[model samples]
Target: MKLTPLEIKQQTFEKGLRGYDVADVQAFLTLVSNEFEHLLNKNKELEHEIEKLTDRVKHYERVEEALHETLQTAKESVEQKMDGAKQEAKSTLQKAEMEADAIIKEANHQRQQIRQSILRLLDRREEIINGISSYLDNAKKSVNQFSKDDMGTFKLPKEEDLEESIDKVTSKSSYSRFELDEEDLEISSYEEEDSAFAPGSDRLDDILDEID
Candidate 1:
């Protein structure tokens, strides 16, 4: 049967001849019951402490597990962000390269167009210069032939004829500013002044100088 501290203290024994002393035995039993009760209380307290310690250990284990999971999640997130950043950088670089190539291509095309325009301008300038030089040579030849004529007095060409010739020569050139008009010719009859027709006359020389 299960025996408690109270039961042990309350237990009774039958008396017999030459048995133990009653008072002494009763005293020893009381002491043993008290000691047993104290031991039981101490054991109960130790068990409570052990239970609390076990609960704390379990709580710590759960916390450690949660921390480990959090760290793992953070690591994965960082890696994913890094990968996204790398992809973005690569895309940006490719776009920039394409833009640079397009700009360079456009610049080269514009440069070529400018070069062609310059060449055309140079050719046009040469044509105008040649036309003006040819016109001046023809004018000089005509003037020399007229001076060598056998006429007694030097006769100037009619104003209308001179104007027509000038118009034809100036039409092929861009130097309109150099064109001469009738007002600038100052042509008149030389019959009154025979010296004007002389070989060493300054009048003819002055006309030729004005033409030049």
Candidate 2:
């Protein structure tokens, strides 16, 4: 059987005539038990320390694993966020380009509309100018016709009579002593009457100048 310190201390050898000295044996057993007990206590203490160190090492390993996982997760999250931001920026840029194209197209359409309106206005202006020109031409024809009628009513000199009057006035006149017969005076009166009405002859010419 196993022996404890107490058992070793209490153990007795049977008495014999010449076995061993009793006091020396008991003292030696006592000494051996004390030393063995001290060794056992030291071993237990070392085992406890080893257990604590093992637990600490496991804790550190767990912490390291958790930190690695967290770092990996953070890196993945950052990449995902960057990808999302890039896609969003691309989408926004495309939308802005489309809007810009639409705005340009609308501007071009509006410009075309304005050009068309200007063309229409120019056509209207041309029509107005043509209408006014036609009206003025008709008015000139009417005025010329009226003036011819008035001349006919006034019984103005014929071409032959006017030529005869010019010959008479120009014939043999002395620059220093000019004189006139009854015929010459009569012709001179007719010419004065013609001169009095001469201002009305240029109405058609004035109307033509305005049209030009």
Best by TM-score: 1
lDDT of 2 by residue, 86-201 (tens): 99999999999999999999999999999999999788778667766666676676656546654455777899999997887778556436666889899989886665433434
lDDT of candidate 1 over 30-79, digit per residue (tens)? 99999999988999999999999999999999999999999999999999
Q: Measured by TM-score, how close is model 1 to the native structure?
A: 0.56
Model 1, residue 13: distance off in Å is: 2.6
Candidate 2 local distance difference test against the native: 0.80
Worst 10 residues of 2 by lDDT: 195-204
Off by over 4 Å in 2: 1-36, 125-212
Pairs that collide in candidate 1 are none
Query: Candidate 1: where is the Cα deviation over 4 Å?
Result: 125-212
